[model samples]
Target: MTLLLAGVTLVSAFGSSFQYGYNVSVINSPAVFMQEFYNETYFDRNGIPMESSFQKLLWSLTVSMFPLGGFFGSLMVGPLVNKCGRKGTLLINNIFSIVPAILMGTSKVAKTFEVIILSRIIVGICAGLSSNVVPMYLGEMSPKNLRGAVGVVPQLFITIGILIAQILGLSNILGNLEGWPVLLGLTGIPAVVELLLLPFFPESPRYLLIQKGNEEQARQALKRLRGWDDVDDEIKEMCREDQSEKLDGRLSVFNLCTFQALRWQLISIIVMMMGQQLSGVNAIFYYTDEIFKSAGVNENNVQYVTVGIGAVNVFMTCVAVFIIESLGRRLLLLAGFGICCVSCAVLTMALNLQATVSWMQYLSIACVIAYIIGHAIGASPIPFVMITEMFLQSSRPAAFMVGGSVHWLSNFTVGLVFLYMVEGLGAYCFLVFCAICLVTFIYIFIIVPETKGKTFMEINQSMAKRNKVEIQMDKEKLNDFQTAAETPKKKEEAHSTSVL
Candidate 1:
């Protein structure tokens, strides 16, 4: 069972989640060069240099299109994953990557920037689908005890992908003018590998057993994946969910929103997803090049620093994979956000000091590095794993839909307005992110329940108990205050004094 789970996670991470990070960081190193091409192409086609703002707008479109495409791709996940199953959606998603790769590879030859933008959108869709599907598939396949660790594998690979893209985008490698297209085009390679290998893995046993009601096939798959024949306990748990889910046919986000039984589970998913993305993780990634420049790093060596930061991210996420189960999801989520909150404050201070102090550039660099480390360990991976843990088979896909949409949309929001925010808010741009992180930490500390070594039923019951306790405490406090107020004026004053 361990070997099988490890093997499946390894392949899925490389094929799917890897592409998400690749798409994200790939455009960074080649930015100036791509803009040059956009200029050259504009001059060739229109016989004049492109206007500066228009050129920036075009570059922004190229860079921002990935997240926009991600938004659309997120919207597609519910229908695709529901209709085709997790594995099938992944297989079909490769088409988006391959076709876009061809278009991007041929962009220079064709001398058209439109093709490259289109490819970005298509590749974005591919990444969006992969990002959502991989986690859910891993979650469904994981055994209860190893679920947290297994769920984090995709995020770990994503950091690896970012590191790889950074290395590939180096000037000596693929970051130069001639090498840019090939860099963009190679995004398809992982997809092709995934397409070939996906068939060798079994369908998600939970999907087959609960969604399809195929006891025999589910049993076989469970046996193959778990390396044991005794499956009564697993099946009984599925039966509990299946009986209710089947009658509902298929649950939608709309259904999840209104379902009283799942209120907190759904709230946890929403708040976690929102906190993860809105905490400014994506903004940090988008802003890295500028952060490096502001820190007075040379332009030539900036990519190296970027790559180094990515390496830290990968290293921290690897640590996260090993420790997530032990610390439990709630603690890590809180710790991750807490560290990031402080890092952001430090970042804001460093940015503010860069003008007054010669060494503050280094402080800014240190702050950004610290922020990335904080995020890689907790904010990046935990919510992704937790979202999968929050819901059952019936509502999992819908939950992912809501979660993925919030994630990509928040990413899109950051990518879209990041430059303007930096221009307008300057160093204080990060203060906003700092505030978001602080509020998110307090909210999670108060509302999100711990889910370590717990079953779904147990988690649900515990949440209910916690909420009830809070409510009763609130009522008791209110009654005590009222009694003090209702006492005779002089006697009430004496009573209040005594209570104080």
Candidate 2:
């Protein structure tokens, strides 16, 4: 973590992840305004009023576009990161935000509600690409010893971004009808900032040496990134290790899909990422106002409470960044998911009892806060960091693709069905989440290795016992090949002796 490294990491986080948090919550405060705009457009087009159900459907589509865009964005991660390089892909990703921001900012004047939907889709793509790329870039750039803390940087900014969005959503700022578009358009600012600043930062050294075969440039980049001239050992280390494991080219998502060797690592990341999203964090954010209302907070003060929870999320993640390397990934994930499991159960009971027991409402609110804390401490940040350490440069993007797709898919599932779950099972919807948390925790506690300070290969080899045997087999084959090649020289010397 040199200053330049820290600065670029922050720049990436702000440009990409900040937009993600912003988009996720920016719609919340102005839900009414946007919905009204939707209805007005429909009425103007049809020359008649729209049905409530239909209006709701349109509004749902509008809100849903962000995650949907993210889904599509996830699918593109492998190819984009592979072809464009992490830094280059992210630079191009600004188009998704800047254009959408304009559309969203001027949606009122354009008199086309469709542009708003379009804006959501574009900005959603922005969030999606950023979410996947920033983590991988930061993780690749970070030194192994400081990797965990530095890797968590994007997530820390994400929490801060969410907090900032929540604060900005207040009516006194940008949540008002006239102000909503401005709020929605604000996502573009980070993109512009990132675009301008990112060119100055060096490309990932791993990408340069391992992927591009530009060893000299890789060495230069590493020196700049590490703030030292003597990066020779570092370059040589990666080159030597990768010489055996290098693929013909960057692996495709399709190849990753079929690759047998990486199956378990792939599964581990898929589960961890899915677990991160499905651990009920977003559902908690969605349920906050009702929870606060149930706890006797007035409607106006609900925003304040939501902001407080956002603050808690930011604060806890900040704490996590400091403690991640020391505590190690496994313990933190277990603690985080374990705390969330209990918190979700408590939340279910509290919600169910709120009608019968007056104090139960307050208890539910406390549970909500506890759950957010639990999520931030472990579940929120570790999965992203773990993805980086889990795969080498060749397979990292594909791993991210799988992870990102699962993440957004799970998140989208929650958004689409959470209300129905609440209606069908009431507070017990958390029971489903509680079950998810418990099973995920058990699997991770038992299976996932502590990737705290290990190199990519060390973590991979330790993850599955079978992988060690496979690697050893490869080494043996290489040794045999070298021996066979040397046998010719021995025969040539023997023939010379016979001639003599």
Candidate 3:
């Protein structure tokens, strides 16, 4: 990769995806302190101590609002990227981060827990935008040969962010009453760094060429990104895509869902994204301390153990980054979900028998770590990369909006429901995750194709069978459809009739 390309990937992922992981885990460390602050604030306000149930409700909102805000942010992707361009949208998104940092940093002094809750929503919006846009931006800027590796970088940074949060959350660090605000506000630093450094990098060449029709500018950007003089071949490849999609314009989410040609591509992303969240990885991340306590670890040592799992998560994700290109996306996914399925089943058994079998507690810890390994390898990173690969330029943004929505919605569902499942099913709650992982594994093994070393068009063509549509592989036959579609003078009418 060119220095410019590498720089872009690192900065973008750190600013955006990193924050997603940070906020997800940061809440865990400060929970007791924040809840104390909330109850104290309420007592001062009402001249009496707050009720436990209401305080619990407030805490639940604080944790859940991030994903809720993420859903709203996903809705904004289609319009923002279309109007601002990928780089421009990311630049503007820093506002979400900086604003929340200020709100959260000052919230303690203000003696209002509501500010922190609101800040979570705002930061969640930033996370949502970053999670969708960074991957889309990285996927577009990367060459096909390096795409899988480049795509995995965002996920790697996410794991790093999670680990950093875990470490800083230690009592010796920022996980205390005085330090919590600073811990919460630290998310803004990456955004500021990205804002300063990212402007120096070039925008996506495909965005410049395909979306804006700026051929010369696209050539310059591609040359800068590729660190080479010869870009005509890549430019021509983009031109063909632009021509193919000229009649389609940019697809709205409605068109994306309705279009028969992209059916499986849409379904694949939805299923993958849903599976990513619903596979219970976040449940493990969210409840790691509790799980360790149940497994007979001392209360004092559970935080250390949580940090260890976070470290293991970072290590496994790094392994995924190095190996993704060599191993291909499909095999990694199969292996990841397969590992998770077995791990979840084993964890359930261990949890059930831990009181009787002394060693079962150790086995439960192993299962949790193994499940993290399974998730990091394939399930976490591949869905975002696949969204970029599955659709052409015209539909990519809408696809992200849809995929990101399902991702966040499923995330919110897990955060909302997993606690209930624990209440109702006890150890058997993990069996639900096992079932999810198994079904997702079967679906991927049977349906999803390996996208290594292929162009966007090639990937789409390969999906035709599962989508149950005939792809016109010949250039002339494709042009004939474009011609018939463009025959009418009204462009909107032409798109409506032709793309259908």
- State which candidate has the highest TM-score: 3
How well is each residue in 1-500 modelled by candidate 1, as lDDT tens digits? Answer: 46777888888889989999998889888888999999999999899999999998888889888988887888888898878988899999999999998999889999999998888999999888888999999888888788888888899999888899999999999999899999999989999899998889988888887777565577677778888877656655555555434445578889978876677777777777777887888777767787788777798787787788889999999998889888888898888889889888888887788789878778777877888888888889988788777777878888888888888888888777777898899878888888888988888888888887876545556765654522112334334434433442453345434221
Candidate 3's residue-wise lDDT over 111-141, tens digit each? 8889899999999999889899999999998
Candidate 1 residue-wise lDDT at 480: 41
Better of 1 and 3 by lDDT: 3
Q: Candidate 3: where are CA atoms >4 Å away?
A: 294-296, 472-500
Q: What are the runs in model 1 whose C-alpha is more than 4 Å off?
A: 244-249, 286-296, 464-500
Give the lowest summed-lDDT range of ten residues in model 1: 469-478
- What local lDDT score does residue 497 receive in model 1, on the 0 to 100 scale? 44
How do the residues 1-500 of candidate 2 rate in per-residue lDDT, one tens digit apiece? 69988898889988888888888888888888888887787788899888999888878888889999998898888888878899999999999999999998998877788888888888888888888999999888888888999888888888988888899999889988789889888888999999999999999888886777565577678888899886655654565446546433456777877776777778788888888888888888888899999889999898988899999999999999999999999999999999899999999999988999999998998889889888998999999998899887778898898899999999889889888988898788999999989988998987788999888767767754743335432455344333433453463444433210
lDDT pick, better of 2 and 3: 3
Report clash pairs, candidate 2.
Answer: none
RMSD of each: 13.4, 6.0, 5.1
TM-score of 1: 0.90
